[model samples]
Target chain A: MTMKKIVLMALAACLALGTTGVYASQADDINALRHYFKKKFPTVPFKEFANGSYALSADKRINWESMRDFPPFEDHVAKGEALWNKKFKNGNSFATCLGNDVTKVRNRFPHWNAKDKKVETLEGNIVACQKANGEKPFGLKKGNIAYLSAYIASQANGQKVNVVVPDDKDAQAAYEAGKQFFYAKRGQLNLSCADCHVYSAGMYARGNLLSPVMGHTTHFPVWRGKWAKKKGDGFGTLHRRYGGCNKQVRAKPFKAQGKEYSNMEFFHASMSNGLTIDAPDYRE
Target chain B: MKKMTLKVALLAAMMATSGFAVAMDEDSYRAEHKAATEALNKAKKVGGEWRDSRWKKSTAVKVDGKKMSYLHAAEAYAAKGDYKNAMKYAGIAKFEGEMGYQQAMDQKNAGPRH
Candidate 1:
């Protein structure tokens, strides 16, 4: 073959491979991450990772057990239940907006919405549902939203994390972006979400133990002890904690319900698939 | 009385050397400001930011945000011709900013998993 022909052929091959490589199946990524965690913490049961730091430390487990006995989040859950059932001014309840049976609802969230070309969170859907029903939506952080999410999550106590990236190009791209965000280091600290949850799991920073990423998704709307100290609000959503973590690393945080965060939540939730729901969980 | 005189004289000399005993010229103010800014940049390189000053809960350095604010305070003092306070605040900002930088660098990528 001529040199020109050989070069052209090589270029064609490279472009082909690059184009094909763009579509990494979500199932493959989930398996790889799960395998990595399983290998790292071989002794810990896969389901137990849902317990977060408690799964890794015996001392913390004792405290976690005690904390669960009182269940500080009980009040929040109760409030959430009321909000979930409360009717809109039009005499339609949140149920009318969300449809019947919310028990398995949390499992379906952080899903790739091909139609919207976006990843949607349960919290976002709740807001959307309320807006659809003529009721004003709550903000993404604390208050009625947190309580509402807590209540909904509580109903799905045993439902597994089942976020999926469908076959659609947009859906796949969203998942890839989320995965990239997880690993991409940002902020002045130059720490990625993976740097803490994946690479540094079970380590200590600032007097707190870090939990493995394996079970990170199972819990949400956690009743954090540090957060509880603030008057009038103790509960926090997954995105609010993300904001706090970003600030801790000296980075400017994105808005709680922003696209980047939603993509991230989709990726994080995907990682914890098959793990049972454990929201209203406690944390330091 | 002799001892008291000696103490007063020593204090005056110390203050003069530290730039706390006299009004500073524009050049001195500029130099101090430049040094503070550079120190802040250095701090940022090791994982601090202008925003770190607002993130009071940052574990990297407790004084980082406070020190960053001092940079602003230093500039204000210099603008008012209070170079003594300006230099003092600048020095503090530099010290704390560097401390934050060092901590961030040392703890580079260190997390619970590690």
Candidate 2:
């Protein structure tokens, strides 16, 4: 080949590689994340991460398993189921937007909305559905919204977390934004999400153990014993936990289901791809 | 005698500018307080605002009376014409805000360590 032609071809290849990022590095990001944890925790069975701190502690596991019979979140889930059937002012219900089969709705969200050009969350859609039906939207963090989500999650109990990053550029950018947010140090404490979840997994932060990133998204709308006593109902969506964590680090929290957090949900959910969905779970 | 007068005048001006003079007056205190607020706003604009940077203004007489929030204390001091205390609190807020902004910039490209 002529030298000039070879140079032209090389330039073309570089252009194809592009400025924002090529998929080569990002495509395997989730896989590499899982592998890193697998390497760090050789003894943990891949499925056990759903149990979080319990997975790392035998004593904690016993305590967690004991709560399985009469989980504190059960009542909250039933309340959610009732909300599912309750009609809006316009007479439409959650079943109108989400189908009668609510059990499968949990795994379907925190997905890329190609048409909207942003990450769409289950809670966001719930609010949207409420608005579309001419009803006041529920709060995103706790209360009836969390209870309804808990019910939807219970329905999807055994489903796998299936977050995806599609081929679209906006979708990729959203994922990248979330990844940056996850790692970026913020607030007075100057701590990132990865600081505790990735680097210090199974380690104690004050009294509570920092759970790993693995299977983190599998459990959601959790009912915490402490939170149950504080916030009217202890059942809270994952976004509530996100807000709480950001506050704990002394950082100002982004609005739940807003672009910043929804994108974060996209990234973190993808990291937990293939993990079983275990919703309405209990935690200390 | 003229030279001596000039030397004294220069020393007096230096002292004023070097913060060896009496505490700031209302106008000077206003300038300092404004600067602290601006730094805090800048940090907030970049989404790097920390919760500790400012707190909810309490209704209690103790904290609402400029006991906890540095900005609040600065305002209370300024109202009482305690420019020394006002300036000190303003300086603390300014430093913290600038630190928060610098941290945001430093972490612009923050990503996975490994």
Candidate 3:
């Protein structure tokens, strides 16, 4: 072939690959996430990632497992159950508002609500559910709502995560926004979520080990040890953790259940599509 | 007392050398704050806005018993007619805004590493 022809062919091929990369589907992104972690930690089984940072460290896993014997979060679940069963003045309860099957709650969240043309999180629904009844909504971070989340999550403990990004344009856009937030650099550190979790997974920053992004969303309403001073119990929701991360990076945290976090939850949860839920998990 | 005098002398010398010796009346401070606000808005447009200062929870620096952002510090200083300090903080905030915008532009195409 002529040199001009060869060059033109190479250019066309490059353009084709670039365009394909740009338009890769959400499923494609999830597959890429799986492949990246698999390559990074070949010995680690994918299912074990439900344990967060423990998946990468044998010592941490041993400690985490010991904690599970008398799980600090067990009492919070009982409290959550109490709250879940408590009826509103209008004779409606979380069980009634959300439905009798609590098993389905965690699996259904971080979903694209077509009616609202926005992402709806479990916390967002709880807020709406409370308003629908004759009660004030709970705060997003901690207190009753987080306790309730911990309880509801405990019910779906073994259910596989199945967050979806629908084929609709707006749904795709929301997912894209979240994907962008994950990868795009933010804050004074000029670090993206991917920078630490994806690129530097298993590495330590100061005294803490950074966990991989894979299966990050399987856990929620964690009983974090550090929260003992602030939270009545050491419990916090995923959004609360998200805020803490943002603050650590010197970025302004988006409100819990706000567009930024809800959309992020959608993308973040989908990354762990097949991983079983491990809610109210303990974390340092 | 000698150490305090030396520290004050060093600060004055640094400020004079950093082009902060110019007129720092309310009008100048306002002009600087306006520029910082505009830069911050621009950075925010691309979702690249940085914290106005290190988090108050992060640092020992405080203003009126509360740690404030560089932007807020500028405002507070201006409110007290400490125009030089106001201008200085406003400049730092403006620097952060521009840096944040540049960082966003650089990472506009950031995605999966693999």
- Candidate that scores best on DockQ: 2
For model 2, report the TM-score of its A chain.
0.91
The order by descending DockQ is 2, 3, 1
Error of 3 at A232 (Å): 4.7
Model 3 pairs in collision: none
Candidate 1 — which residues are off by over 4 angstroms?
Answer: A1-22, B1-50, B53-114
Instruction: Give a tens-digit lDDT track for model 3, residues A1-284.
Output: 99999999988998887963566688899888888889889999999888889988989889889988889888888888999999999988887778899888888988998989999999899989999887999999988888899899889999999887887889988888888888888888878899999999999999788998888888888888788867477888889888888877777677798888888888898898999998888888
Q: Flag the better candidate by lDDT, 2 or 3.
A: 3
lDDT of 2 by residue, A1-284 (tens): 99999999888888887843555345478778878888888999888888888999888878888987789877888899899989888878999998878877888898888887989888899999999988999999999899898889888988888887888889988998888889999877889999999999989988888899878888888988879688477778889899888888877677888888898888888888878998879888
lDDT of 1 by residue, A89-118 (tens): 888886775657979677778887767789
| Sliding window of 10 residues with minimal summed lDDT for model 2 chain A | A19-28
Selected candidate, larger TM-score, 1 vs 3: 3
Q: Report how far residue B111 has shifted in candidate 2, in Å.
A: 1.1
Cα RMSDs, all models: 7.6, 6.7, 8.2
- Which regions in candidate 3 have their CA more than 4 angstroms from the true location? A1-22, B1-24, B54-60
User: Would candidate 1 be rated incorrect, acceptable, medium or high by CAPRI criteria?
Assistant: incorrect
Docking class of 3: acceptable
Flag regions of model 2 displaced more than 4 Å: A1-21, A24-26, B1-25, B55-69, B76-84
